[model samples]
Target: MAEIQTTTLIDDLTGKPLDAEKAHRIHFSVEGKTYRLDVDEKGADEFHAALDRFIEVSTKVAAGGASKRAAAAPRRASAGSGEQTKMREWAKANGYEVAERGRIPAAIQEAYAAAN
Candidate 1:
């Protein structure tokens, strides 16, 4: 007898799995609500491409403070989809137990920023 195991990641928008690559997780905010999505490389690129123009023109905001724009819970990854992936990868490499999905911890985010 033989035993085998497999795990497949599906794209949130397309509900399809990539043949050779795992999906990337995307975190974004709109109107004050935040969301997380898992997508393949092409989908990740498309999401960022659609937002690049707006991102280039938008002012950067600090993550925490009494400032009006500060989120109720401190948030990270105003950075584009690629950068967000980098941050998550960095966190895992540096001994942080980041999940394959969901929010990365604030400490991990701060360390990533400081190191970069």
Candidate 2:
């Protein structure tokens, strides 16, 4: 029979040594709550698998968020364009204290857009 060899486990990110019990456990936090998941000797592999899935899903979500903002950029640009200057002038003429430069109020923008 061959002798079984035992080795210490180390956390890749924290650079901390883990004993057998801890090495067989995964720790995580969600919404201010902390939780631990214990597994058999396959725990290390399972933890890595979960981490991979989390990264993949979050990456997709982040990409979708960026695209949503990109899609809104054109509307934001139009809001500050010459149409807004025309609206500000209209609002000031109609007794609304329009700012010299900055965001024009939504009511003024709506009325001007409707007028045009």
Worst lDDT 10-window in candidate 2: 59-68
Clashes of each: 0, 0
TM-score of each: 0.46, 0.38
Model 2 misplacement above 4 A: 1-23, 27-34, 38-75, 79-82
Instruction: Give the alpha-carbon lDDT of every model.
Output: 0.79, 0.67
Q: Model 1 scores what on Cα lDDT?
A: 0.79
What lDDT tens digits, residue by residue, belong to model 2 across residues 1-116? 89998887665545567666656667765544667755554556767786887767663433234335334444544465676788888888888888888888778877777877
lDDT of 1 by residue, 17-96 (tens): 85545568888777656789798888889999999999999877665322365448864437677777999899888888
lDDT of candidate 2 vs native? Answer: 0.67
